[model samples]
Every structure is written in C-alpha cells, then in structure tokens.
Target: MSTSPLPRPSDLIARRRAEVAALLATDAAQAALAIHGTPLLLLDTARVEQQFRRLRDALPFVRFHYAVKALDHPAALAVLDRAGCGFDVATSEELALLVDGSVDTARIIHTHPIKKPAEIEHALAVGVRTFVVDNDAELAKFSRAPRDVRLLVRLAYRNPHAKSDLSSKFGVGFHEAERLVREARRRGIRVGGFSFHVGSQLDDPDRFVHAVDETIAFMSRLERQLSVRFDTLDIGGGFPVGYDRDVAGIEDIASGIRPSLERVRGRYTILAEPGRILVAEAATLVTSVMGIAERADGRWYYLDDGVYGAYSNVVAEDVHPLVFAVTELDGDAEQATHRWATLAGPTCDSADVIAREMLLPDLRVGDPLASPAMGAYTAVTSTRFNGRPLTSIAVLSQAPATGEVAIPAATSGVGGPQPQTVP
Candidate 1:
C-alpha cells in the first residue's frame, strides 16, 4: 500500500511538470527544448554509487567492470568512473569513447569473444593489454600479431534459470576453451584467465556460485594437464536488477557467491561484467499519453514513444513494459482505478504495441507514464523504424541536504546529431 496518498492524474501531471521545471530551471534553454514534450530517461547516479559501495564492502577482492553496452552515455560513464570502476568494452568505438572521456586505456579491457584484427592491433597500440578470445581461430589471429598481450579464454554453459531466457550461442565448449588456453601458452602469449556469462536477468542467486565452482574445477584440471595456471577469472555479467516485485535483490544474489569464493584455490583474480543490475533500477523512462480510445471490448492508449524508442524491447523480445500511471486527488484522497488499458505506440506497424491487456485506471491524453528498469536495454537498442526519434536523456545526482534528486545538465537533441534520434 502507498503510505503517501496518490494524487489525481491532473495533479500528478502538474507535480511532474513542476518537478521537471524546477530541475531544468538552471539548465540552458536549448537543453530544455531538446528534452521538452517527449519521452525521457532519468538516471540516478547516487544509486549507482550505493550499489558500488555495497559491492566494494562485500567483495573487496573482486573488481567490477561496468559493461559499456548496457548504457554508455557519458554522464552515466562519469558516475561509474567517479565510483572507481573500470569498463568492459566490445568494440573499438567504445574504447575510443573511453579515451575521449579521459578514462584510462589500461583500465578498459577489450573482452569481446571475437575481435577484428585491426581492433586488436589498435587496442594493443593504445595500451589495452587484456583481451578475451573463445576459439582457436580468434586466438591464432592474435597469436601472430607483433605485440604480446594477455589473453582470456571464454567458456559456454547452460543456466536453466535466466530471466532474459538466453541459451548458449556465444561461448566455446570446455574442450575448446582448454585448446585456446594451451595454444596461447604455445604461442608465448600471456594466458591471463577464463571467462563466462550465464544469461542476463538471472533470478537464481546460486547461478554465479555454481558456475564459479565448475570454472574452478575446469581451471584446476587444465592446470594439472597442461601445466599452466591463469591469474584472472572473469565471471561475465548477468547480475539481476529489480524490474517487478518478483525480481531478486543484489544482496540475495551475491550471498551465494561467498561459499564458492571460499572453495576456490588459486592466485587468480576474480572480476565481473555488470551492466543491467547497475543501471536498470537506477533509471526510469517517462513518456506521455498521446491518444486514448475506448472500444466495446477493450481500451487503447497510445504513447508518443514506441517500439522505435522506449518500447524497442517489446518489438525485439515481445515483452510488455511495466507501466506506472500517476494521478492527483482531492481531499488528500488517493486516485482509484476505474478501467483496464492496452497500451500502443504512435506507429503504423501492427507490431507496435507496448503492452496488451494491461490494467490501468481511466486515463486521458497527455498523462505521463513511467517505466522503471528501462535504463539498460531501452536507449541503447533503439531503432529508426517508421522514422521515429529517440527519447531525450538526463542524469540525476542526489542532493545531500534534501535527500531528493537533483537533475543535472544533459546532452540532449532531437532527430539531428544523434542517429538514433532521427525521425
């Protein structure tokens, strides 16, 4: 139950606008114009710090490499850098971003399972020593290079409890992983470690511990057979963040890894690629209702942002977004639900639906809807389908005195500079 009474829809809209107005008051008029009257993502940098501190306190020995692919905005990247975390990058473009952002090149690892030779050469030239490879072909490409670098072999396995429900199509098998490791040794390259990622949004807390245990066993066997030992083990990113009530907490998931950590016997280092869990709950996407229609059988509410924007995942995965409707009320009373709604987007495609059979109160046009857990995949995976523009973006830092969010200046534009925003 909501301890604070919910306001009516008009009051809620008024409050939200007032909040945005005050937050944007200090920002330039251009910033306001760029972000005005559209769906926007708000990121809470403070929450990310809190999560980082929790990890530092719990697992001080391990390093958390923030996956840039999750949400690579410079403002968000600044938050992680200030929090004392490194980066896990897949492409040369991400590496260039880090370099331009003044992030240490040595701290960023080129960890894509498959990397182009030019990318590898650029990474080595730029002082990125660590790279991950999954097969002998990728290893062979790197082995012939003029520069020697630290190589990590990636392995694949099944995790039956992934929330995102991804199966193994990425990593190499155990034997293949061993072959890559041995070949690296034969080529005089530094056999740095092993890595694996159990799918994303995994609810099972023991999944990491279980994979770690198996990995430890595999490493031990390989060491005894090949007479080689690796010093780093990257347990790839699959950390879970709260989406709905059913999503598990970080503490609940990390609690299981302690037992496995105690059993691991090596001078090896442990690391993780955490993307979604760090940014998912810390950000929210705000979109406005553009139109509403009530049919004899159902009700449909259309939003300005659709599958090409905030609801891109719905088009990609056929999953509905969790939407929260806000409203204002009189006499200190909370708003009550009156009807159900099926939310659609402002697109001509028949597949542009956001949510079907969603329950909502009697809502109206121009009312704002918030979808939490949207920070990870929404913005990065957006498209230009139907020539729709990308949503505006903003960052929030906590005010120590007020304990409320203070929205800082953001890089915002519409359908112009950013290709993702061209409509």
Candidate 2:
C-alpha cells in the first residue's frame, strides 16, 4: 500500500498566501483592503470547511459546532455558516456578533459554563435554547430564563493528560451530572443532553473517547434511574490540532475517537464545540518589532501589539506565546538566544510582558514577527488596555485537496469575494 506525502509547514504557508491573493484579486474587496497595517490575522476559510466536512463525514452521527470564540471574523463565520455548522458562544456579546452577522439564530447554541443574568436573558430572547449548566445556582438561573431553554449538563473532563485544568474550572463532576439532569427535569425545562471539554492542546486522542464514555455511562445510569432519555451529548470542543511537533495530528485524534463514538450511534445527539482545534493553525498574528533593548544579562524585543492588545493571554494566563520572525533575521548568540527571553510590549505599564524568556532566532526593530496558532484566544480576547486600536485583519483560504493557501488582500473587514473553486 502507498500513502500521500505530508505537506511541509513552508509549503502549507505558501499555499495559504496564494489563496489570499486570489481572494484579494476580486474587485469587490480590492478597494476595502488597508494598504498599510501593522499586525494582522490571515484566516483559511476553505481549510476550516474542509476540516468540518471531514469531521462530519468521519463521524456522520455527530454534529460539529464551530466555536465562534475561536475566530469571529465575519468571513470565517460565513464559512462555518455555509458549511452547515452551528455556532457556540460564551457571552451575549458573542451571540450578538453572530446574530448581527446573519448567522441563523436557530443554529446558535449559548454555552458558557458561567452565565450571567443578562447573557441568559439575551440567549433566551434570541432563541438560543442549547446551554450547559454546572451548578445549582446556574441551574436555578436557567430555570428562571425568560423562555424555555434546552440544557446540556456539563461533565468534568478530569483526564490527567489535559494541559489546562479545565475539569477543575468548569463542568459538574461525572458523579454529579445525573443530579443536574434531574434538576433540569424537575424544572420543567427540556434537558437536551450533556457536554464535557478536555482542555486545550490535548495530546491524548483517547481523552475524547474517555470523556464520551464517561458521559454516556452517566447518562445511561441517569436515564435508567430517572427514566428519561437525553436528546444531546455535547463533547464540548477540545479536538486537538498540532501547534508543534509534540502535539498529536488531527488524524490521530479523529481516528482514535471515531470507533468509540460510533458505538453510541442511537443514544444521544452528539455535538461538539471546537474552538482551538478549528482555527488555531488557520491564522497567524503579524506584529512588528518596534525596538530591541540589550542588557548585560540579556536582550528584549518590544512589539507594537503587546500583552494589552494582542498578547493578552500571556499575562492573563501566563502562557509563553509561540513567536517567530515573520520575515527572516540574521545574528548571533549574544543577540539571539535559542532559550527563552523576556519579550515586552510598548506600553507605560511595567507589567506589559508578552512572553518571558521565549526562544527566538534573533531580534531587530521593524522586523515582522509572526505567531502561528494565534487564531484562537488571541484577537477575540484582545483589550484596549492602553487605548490601542485593534489591528487590521485578513482572511486566507486553502484548497485542502491541493494544500494551497492564499493571502487575500482584505478589505475593511470580512467582506471578501465568494470563494473560487479549485481545479
């Protein structure tokens, strides 16, 4: 047997640039594109659709909802909308964004572990029935929602392999899912199903299966006890995507879980809220190195988009963001350290550090720095901490069949041309 050759990172990136160019060539978006912008995001809409389709085909029984919090760019949302995927939102702000973008209200699922009254009210008013509740207070809040809402009890994904401690932060424990389900039944609201998130950059593919199995067993026990069947089982997003070599590939994760999910075909409505997996590798954050400072001990690279605006995750979560030279740079050890070095943003605050002790090739002012896998939790979590304006954004499209990526000259926003068919 023979297999197809895998695509190299460079090859994949080049293909993405071409897709963007083709999208920009269309007369519709040419004039709207900003000729000059510092930091930008390039989205691969085609790749997203391809990934969604592949998931759908492989797990025909499951429903894949694109977590809009990943990349809410209008164009990207449009792609998911057309691909027949629903949107998952954590807040009313996100819900409004999708609704304003013309997303079908019927397809939206309001699923924040911690829901405020306004968010709950708006979700109810906006026809967002699907929700995930963890505690009694949240259940009480949902029970009193202005409209009838469908509830999916969130379960704890306590897999030790998960990078983030999401199990501790969100979801009712596996032992507690039944109680929540019963509470929903008692409230007279429809209990749609259950959900669980396995955390970010999950290296273990079986983690998903583990979560599903745990959810199913719990749901089954509850059904037998309460004599009620669940209508849905949301495997709340955490489909892994390779951001580095150490991370597992999409195929590995998908292949590992397909068999497990297939066994539960008739049990419940299988849905997913995939955020990082869907858009993590599809976009890059382009930032310019404003200046470089050298100390006797080390050197620092200052960027236009700092921890305040673009790299909020660094400070908020203390995550050492992956940084790369957008263009190439040439220098030596005293200048460039393979080991981690502290990188800060250009702001008055002393705590505005992007990545402390991050590995890099070299440093220079005015050089473009590219951060991959930034499509998720980067721009959407951005803040005008120092009144910095949001950087302009561009969307990229890829032909999955050919592994070709294009860099479309983006107009003001997501108003790009209808995608061109690949031969």
Candidate 3:
C-alpha cells in the first residue's frame, strides 16, 4: 500500500505560520498586546501542562525532570511542579528558582557534571540527593557529602547533527566512563546507574534507542565486572521540537526506545530530562516593526525584538522560528503582495539580524509580527544588548467561557508591576 508523503519545507513553514497566527488571534494574545504592547511573549501555563502531559503519556514508566534551563519562569515551574514533574537543574540559581517556588527538594536533581563547591553545598543543603558527575574531580567533590548522596555517571554519545551536541562538553566515552565508574567506586561514591544525552534537539529516533541499548549493555557489563549495581538510568533530554519544520514528536521518539526500556522496566529506575520539548511550544512572541529601511540588498524590516531578545534561540541553537505578519493570520495575507526581505532586530550590532531573506508582506513601521515555539531557550538566553530592556512576558490563562483568554500578571523578569489582571 502507498503511504502519504511527508510535508515539504514550504508546507511546514506555512503550517507553523498558521499556528502562530491562530495564537495571535487568541484573547490572551489580544489582551497582552493591549496592555504590554509589542516585543512581548504570551506564556500559556496550560500549554506547558499540556506538553508535560504529552511527554508523560508518551513515556509512562520514565520519570521526567523538566530541565530548568529551558525556561525558568516561575509560572512554568509552578505549573510543572503542580503536575508532579521533577526538575533537573545545572546551577544553584536554577535550584533557587525551584526552592523559591516551594518545590519539594525531593523532586530536584543536580545534573551539572561540574559544579562549584558552593553550588554542591547549596543543593545538598536543600535536601537534593541525586547528582550527576562525569569526572574524578567532580566525584571527589561529593566524596565528603552524606552517604545517601548518589551520582549518575554521565556517558557521552556524540551526534554532530544535533543542534547542540552536549556530549562534547560534559559526557564520558566508553573508556573514560569505565575509568570514572571505577574511580567513583574507589572513592566510595554510589554510582547510580548511568545517564547520557544523545544530543540537544536530536531528530534521530534510532540514536535514542541506540544510546539506551548501549548504556544498558555497558551498565550490565560493569555490574558483572565491578560487582556494583546501578539502580537508575537517565536518558538525558534531546527530544526535538519542530520550530520551522516538521520533526519527530515525543511519542515517536518514545516508541523507538520503549521496547528497549520495557526489557528492563522494573530492574532500573528510568528517568528523562526534557527541556525543549516540554516548554518550547508553550510561548508565543509578538514583535512590531520598529523601523523599515531599504538596504542595498533589499528591503529590511527592523523589529523591536531580535536575536538579542526572544530570538536568541536562532543564534544559540541554530533553529529558525517561522515569522508571520499579523496580516497573514488575519486572512489578508493572500491579497497582499510579498517580497523577500531581511528581518533585523533593534540593535546597533550587525549580528542582531533575525532572519535573512524572509518573505514577508509589506509591513508598516508599526505593523506586528508573531513567532511561535518561542518558549525554550529564547527569553532565558536573551541578552540586554544596546541598553535595551528585556521583552516582557505576559502569563496567560483561560477564562470560564470557551476560547476566552486572561492574563494573570506581567511576569517577573520584564521588571513589570506585580500580579494584576489585564482585561
């Protein structure tokens, strides 16, 4: 039997544009725009809860720790915490975000392979027990900790194709992992099973299954040779999100590795660190054209927000988020003429260009544009360059009536007033 063809790049772009358009038309989007104006992010905690549920349903047996670095907004953390999602933090500051939110320390894990001694002490002080270490130096820091502290040996599986190959900076290879595990044993550190990240934003499902299979095999071999038992396996987060193109979903990746995990289901505690997938689609960015210029190459539209702001994911993760003019979503795009133009950010730096050769409708200086999937690594990685203020984020919730939107408050990072309704 013949199967349906996959979506082309143009089709994916159109779909994403339509999706962003729908978000812009929502009551919450309108309310945020009315109150906060342009260069704003509408964060839907309901969407965060939905994405978390999707990840949970996809991998029912695996305990998911929402990687705090993705988007550390208190609203996002509160939603995930309420949903009973654990947190994976890399630094004391991230842990503090959880702690300040009153998240139970039992649900937190320190995943930074290398940490300052003070950071380790802070985590331990807060009742955090599980930690990850990739080298002898890191393991040695935990040597003086209480006997109940357990560490996961980080193993590296390189995939250069991923947006970010985390293995390069923080994981151990086969021989190196063997050495670390043996070294940890010598120091009397409890090496809880193993943990590895295939890579960040990895699209290959087979890579995840391969990492799981390989790690399980290595764990078994070490258990036999070293006579040490490992009780946990953290398959680090790399689940891909379709930014400007179609990619594998959590269910697809979960299905690929579920069989292998099922083989050792009860024998080991399976854990996953999902950062991007859980929060990326939960936010939408709205920016307006601050200025328009006719450069030598073509027409250039300068938006108030750029790579230095919400679009930092473009420069850092190499993922291009689809940009749509508000007209495109309002059903007038087809009637308007389009041209290939460069979209730039409001910054003196040349590197602040958001999208090169973007096909957009003729937009005025004040026309609005929206980009979806702006939740992960966008605001968190944004910089206050050119003396510009960070773009404000408006936390959104649903009204009693279907399809209505409500803004609970302008969030903290934007330096806005405390919780107040945006009618």
Per-residue lDDT of candidate 2, residues 1-423 (tens digit): 112232334544444434434543543223323444566665556667777777777677778788887777777787788889889998887888788878888888877878888788887787887888888888888666644567887777776666565788887775677777777678876777888888865767777767777777877787788888777878777766544344565567767777767777776677878887777666656677888877654777888888776676565534455666643322122333354456788787878878765556565787776666566667777776776776556666554567655444553332333444322
lDDT of 3 by residue, 1-423 (tens): 112222333767777767777777777678778888989998988989999999889889999999999999888888899899999999999998888889999999989999999999999999999999888889889888999998998999989889999888998887888998888888887888789989989978899999999999999998999888889999999999988878998889989999999888798999999999988998989899999988788889999999999899999999798888886676666566778888999999999989997777788989998888999999899988888888788988765465555576665352233555555
Off by over 4 Å in 2: 1-34, 144-148, 316-321, 327-342, 356-363, 397-423
Judged by lDDT relative to the true structure, which candidate is superior, 1 or 3?
3
Q: Which run of 10 residues does model 3 get worst, by summed lDDT?
A: 1-10
Error of 3 at 256 (Å): 0.2
TM-score of 1: 0.84
User: TM per model?
Assistant: 0.84, 0.80, 0.95
lDDT of each: 0.70, 0.68, 0.87
Worst 10 residues of 1 by lDDT: 414-423
Model 3 spans with C-alpha error above 4 angstroms: 1-11, 399-405, 412-417
> Residue 121 in candidate 1 has what lDDT?
83
The top-ranked prediction according to TM-score is 3
